[model samples]
Target: MEKKNNRYSLLLVGLAVLLVVGLVFTVGRSKKPTLNVYNWSEYLPAEIITAFEKEFGVKVNYDTYSSNEEMLAKLSTGATGYDIVVPSDYAVSIMIHQDLALPLDKEALPNLANIDPRFLDLYFDPGNVYSVPYLWGTLGIAYNKTKVEEPVTSWEILWDPKYKGRIVVVDDMREIIGMALQTLGKSRNSTDPAELMAAKAKLATLVPAIKAFDSDNPKGHLLSGEAWLGVLWSGDAALAGMENPDITYVLPEEGGGLWMENLVIPKGSRNPELAHEFINFILRPEVSAKLAEAFPHGNPNQAAHALIDPEILNNPASYPPAEALEKAEWLIDVGEATVLYDQIWTEIKGGR
Candidate 1:
């Protein structure tokens, strides 16, 4: 009886030991740090994240969004836990204003010098406090030359009777309205309620001509010949031109919209130091050059520019002429006036 009792006791002790060991193992694995990043779809080079993970001994959880508003809605919910995000210049301002961004620790980012000072301290995030500029480009029309009778040099061509039912523009409200405003000799960032109304009225006229308002893949329509002309970003234009040589990108004579993409750390970042490290890694000359090769946008890194082919820099559609650069205006947030912007945009898009 005594021996049997001892065996039972020994078995119970062994079970407790095994349970403790299992808990320890699980805890160690769970403690391994990770970072969560949310960025625009098709924005980053493929292997940049992989390289970052390997170099830092950290795991990266990456995701993508189609538009700045989509990202804002998700981030505002406070459950996504995204540590790093990339938004355009105006979106960065909105994010900063809404307290969605965390102040960047400059010491962690040694490569900030690689970015052009000219791009820095713009109306958005002055002194580069909350964000770092990523890629810069203009909005323009890309069309299939074989299908288009003449080169499209004006935003009005998007509404031409000949191209009706064969045009796609970005789904962004600001961009669509800005295109009309520029065509009408108004500023892209005009805060005047009257000018916005005029822009809205002009856009309403072009609504029937649009096949679709697609921000994600407008180039697909042009490439597939479903739509011969599109209001497309320079990167998408570059991709379409590569897919078929018959495609051509044209910057409007009226000075189309200009924008900058930026990298920012979210307020609740679990790994701010790691996020900064990754940002610096992306800013590296060789790294930025590789990104430009894959994405084909105007990289703001001077060192990267030196590495890329001169022809890419010389591409008029991507870089634009010196005079156009001087005339272009950067977008800024109008604060409480967004309600007006939204109302006009909704009215135009919802009319038909």
Candidate 2:
């Protein structure tokens, strides 16, 4: 009886040791951190994410949204666990004002020096204390050469009755209104109620002509011949031109809005250090060049310029002339005026 009891006790002890060992191993394996990133649709190359994961052993949970408002709304709820987000210059300003973004730790991002000085210390996050410039481009017209005989030089072409049902505009409130404001020789960031009303009136004329309002893939409309002319980001226009030689991107004579998308850590980041590591990794010259090659936007990293493909570097659409940039205006945060914008945009879309 004593021998049998000893065997039973020994077996129980062995099982307990095995269970503790299993728990320890499981906990150790689960300790690997995850970095959640929220960015624009089709913004980052897949390989970059893979490379970062392999190098840091940190899993990347990347999610994409089509607009700044969508990203802002998600983060504002404070329910999401996004560690990083990309927002446009004006949106960055809004985030800063709302305390939705966290200040960047420059010490962790030593590669920030690769960014061009011209893109730094701008109206949004002056001194770049809270954000890093990722990609930049202009809002302009992209037209199919075979579909339209007229030279597309101005925003007025989008409102021409002849092109009715063949034009596509981005489904963004600020961009569409900004274009109208530009056409009227006003600031894209104009807050005057009278100016906004005038812009809204001008946009009303385009209602009948717009075939579809798309922000995700306006290039698809242009590629399929469903849209002869489109208001598009320069990078999207560049991609369309590459896919179909008939597509051509042109800056309107009246000038257009210039925007810079930025990388920022939100206020509730779960892995702030990891976020900084990822930002530094992306700012590397080689990595930034790869991004420029994949997205074909205006490369803000001066060091990446030498490594960029000549075809992309020389593309006038991707890198507009100095004069065009000089005339361009960055969209600034409009604060409470945003409510007015929202009302007008809703009215326009509702055909009110």
The lDDT of each candidate is 0.85, 0.91
Kindly give the stretch of ten consecutive residues in candidate 1 with the minimal lDDT sum.
Answer: 322-331
TM-score against truth, every candidate: 0.87, 0.89
**Can you write out model 2's per-residue Cα lDDT over 97-201, one digit (the tens) per residue?**
889999989999999999999999999888999999999999899999998888888898887888899998888888899999999999989999999999999
The residue-by-residue lDDT of candidate 1 on 34-153, one tens digit each, is 889898888886698888888888898989998788998888888567889998898998898889999998998989999988788988888999999899988888888898978677
Q: How close is candidate 1 to the true structure, as a TM-score?
A: 0.87
Query: RMSD of candidate 2 to the true fold?
Result: 3.7
Clashing pairs in 1: none
- Pull out the clashing pairs in model 2: none
**Total clashes, candidate 2?**
0
Determine the backbone clash count of candidate 1: 0
